[model samples]
Target: MSTPELHWFKSSYSSSNEPGDCVEVAVASAAVHIRDSKTPHSARLAVAPSAWVNFLAVVGERR
Candidate 1:
């Protein structure tokens, strides 16, 4: 199956004027897409929405 077109955006936490190490994400109905902002065309990761939520929760807890 062909990949759907995704509108990716950088995390709001990334406030640097110059591009640094950051990740981009695109939300889809079935999954969340994640990729290195510096390398958009490189390999990406796709995770279920629930998994994404859990991952974010874990990260937030560490903050």
Candidate 2:
């Protein structure tokens, strides 16, 4: 089966002036998708919604 179209949004950290240094996010069902803005058509990393939250928490704690 083919993948459905997803509504993607740019990361807040992504600047309009930047090209390759960008990230896009999309949420589908219970999974979150992350793709490189420069190669959006390529494969994206998928993570569980809960896992994504945990990942963000770790990143936040490190910051």
Candidate 3:
């Protein structure tokens, strides 16, 4: 009948509230979700737990 609800929140990694560069995250039992903070209603990217960890590893390497 109706869509489910998601308690999305801004990523802690986002240091400042300047503008533009912002991302949000939501963790669920099945997947880790990411969406643009500027457009919360837009499409999002969902990844498995292991995949999320691997992705962070790569991002950490670059930074």
Best by lDDT: 1
Tens-place lDDT digits, model 1, residues 1-63: 997899999975464685867889999999999998988999999999999999899888877
Q: How do all the candidates rank in terms of TM-score, highest first?
A: 1, 2, 3
Minimum summed lDDT over a 10-residue window in model 2 is located at: 11-20
lDDT of each: 0.87, 0.86, 0.83
Which residue pairs come into collision in candidate 3? none
Better of 2 and 3 by TM-score: 2
Q: Report the C-alpha lDDT of model 3 over 1-63, residue by residue, as the tens digit.
A: 854577888776675766667889988877999999888888999999899989888988877
For candidate 3, what is the total of clashing residue pairs? 0
**Which residue runs of candidate 1 sit more than 4 Å off their true CA positions?**
1-3, 13-18
The window of 10 residues in a row where model 3 has the poorest summed lDDT is 12-21
Clash totals for all candidate models = 0, 0, 0
Candidate 3 wrongly placed segments (more than 4 Å): 1-4, 15-20
Count: clashes, candidate 2: 0
